[model samples]
Target: MSTSASQQADLDPASFRAIADLAYRESGLTLVQEKSSMIQSRLRHRLRDLGLADFAAYCSLVQSDAGQGERRNLISALTTNVSHFFRESHHFDVLRAELDRHLPKLRAGGQLRIWSAGCSNGQEALSAAMTLLDHVPDVARLDLRILATDIDPEVVQFARKATYPERLVRGISPDMLKKYFDQTTEAGHEPSYIAKPVLTDVIRVNELNLLSPWPMRKRFDIIFCRNVVIYFDQRTQEKLWPSFLNALAPDGVLLLGHSERIAEPERYGFTCTGPTTYRPCHALKSTARPEKQKQSEG
Candidate 1:
């Protein structure tokens, strides 16, 4: 169908706003007026699946109390989850370097925690696991684990399954692929690879909504929330900076998308150490600010 036909025949402004508001409230995803056409395009599948005639009916259902269960479907349709193994290579290099420095401490029975917030389809978390395994072969035996989470439960389940098609595994080196994944071909399906127990054993997949309160009790030594914040507005993004800071252990590292940066690092008690990489100010004693100063600076 043509774009004009879809927009004019399906959704009106009121219905689009309703969806945008729901998305923002539930998932912190900012769907502004400019996204009206895109929103209509994305939600067409839902309308077809439900046998709805237009966006007005879809909106009525989603906004009513009876449509609570459909909200998840709405989010799944609207949110994009384009990711791949080693999507951002430099972050892995930095992780490897950090692990090298922390090797002595890890060997001394110290605990290490890494959180892959907004971990879509488990690539980011799995990449971290691969890096750790490459640097510290004994990571599995140590008190180390990667917490991979995404708001989409379906993707979380997919991550737990640890299987990917040949296309998705293209960037992974053959040596690493051979070491970490096992080839499998179903009777009628295309050839696929599944992560071996050695790799999957050290990672935990969870379905979590970042907008909601975090349930974990421990702080993370490293956090990978790359590219996920782009969907949120600046205000929503600002609110998350403090939460991420508080969740990170002192001296912990926070890795962001290539285009994402902490707007005011000093205010959040973070200092840029590398491109899209930050460390808590407390980690740098010399640069630590007084509580009063920090408050005033923010």
Candidate 2:
């Protein structure tokens, strides 16, 4: 009564929905119903690679402790990391304004720290650096830095290399294009944009998974978790919001995707501003009065 390869390929809709739910819980992303075909297509490759003809057997492999590598592969396959330089323009604009507004007031020992929680490539982080360098004076002397991270090892490596197809440079400003990048041909054919010295001022890319406990104990002045959160389910979003709040400094600001907003910022001590930005509410220090402490003495 074992299912055939074709039978397994035709796994019931329920199974697909279950996989989607698991993915949402694990990665904070949703696989739309239309993506069943996409799931089947991609998982089929994993099935073949694992030598499992049936989807049930593949699912079993993914669930088993011995199959942890396969599970990661499944996650990598499902998560889409399509990001570009200045993909959402207003956010960067806000970043520039914030830098202009905050740079001079920062304490001597305090540095400007920003996190691009799901930075796919290095573009967003680089863009942030460029903004700071352009707007803030002596940015290098200011102890400013960006921590950019992504779940995918492939993209992380790409970010490390900091190379991209020449066509990807369309949106980059001409002045920045010339100042920060070197245009060169690699392997004697394709054009590549390589990072120059200016980029050294801005970003440090890391391999990070947002759903997992953050390795960073310190807080960031600003965190950009845009577009990425929308993929997560409401429950996961609820859990993540508090973690993000905790990761922010007393006056830290969080910039979320334009389409996303916290349902209850007051619960997390986050006060909403505009559509999708949040600031940590500064807690007033309370000192107990002697009279109040002795209220029952009378």
Candidate 3:
């Protein structure tokens, strides 16, 4: 084959289309032609790991009925996992306030749940745990837990390990880092930190696809779905709004990435309570306007 033909065959147009369709069907992720080169680069390792020479064969395997298992790995490779401790610091502030508000009910034997939806590598959930501790040092005694979930099983496993190298944890303050992380490094390796039981003890990690049906019967007090839905197309995103709204307690808050917005959240039973933050207003499914930010009830 000519060099151009070989290059085309490597990530053939058909293969690209197949990969994109498979990703959307399996995980509600959107792919466009402009990103084909980047997708090709990302999946090249998968091809090699599977002992394949090019995208065509890899695509064939992943798109077939027998390709069911590989679909997970394919989505894992395609998904982005950039995250840090206490990203979008304001959300942590909101968490502090919410935890404080719920302290009374929690002390009275009520449960408080927070979910780090699309939680990548555990930082977001850990950060929430830290925030909860900061707000109420005795929080572990209460029925409180942070569910950290991601579609990528590998990343979920990484989160469950609760270990982080220096670079991935840059957002953590020195004092909090010292208090919450144990230096778990060996003599020859670069310095790394593992979340102490004080943090991890309150967190549960699981692999979950946001597009799939959620198994939790209990609604959450806070849902941090930041920087996640941006990967989906408008229809996919809109479909997610109702699920998130239903998953949240009536007065519960939902936070999104700075760039992500539910096109008029009130339409989907949420009121913009803060910057890219929302609270369920289920009563307003039809004619409710965005209400003024209401404080969480104590």
Per residue, candidate 1 scores C-alpha lDDT tens digits across 90-162 of 8888788767766778889988889999998999988889888987787889888899999887788899999
lDDT of 3: 0.86
- In angstroms, how far off is 51's CA in candidate 3? 1.1
lDDT by residue (176-222, candidate 3, tens digit) is 99999998877887889999998998899999998999999999989
Off by over 4 Å in 1: 1-9, 286-298
Lowest-scoring 10 consecutive residues by lDDT in candidate 2?
289-298
lDDT tens digits, residues 1-298, model 2?
A: 2234543575457768767766776677788888788788767767766667666776776667887787678888887777888777767766776676566665365588899988887777877877777776477676687899988777788888888887777778889888878988878668988877667556888888898889987789889998888877788788888899899877677888767878877787776654466777562222111111111110
Residue 288 accuracy (lDDT) in model 3: 29
Deviating ranges (above 4 Å) for candidate 2: 1-18, 105-109, 283-298
* Residue 30 of model 2, lDDT score: 81
Please count the clashing residue pairs in each candidate, in the order shown.
0, 1, 0
Which candidate leads in lDDT? 3
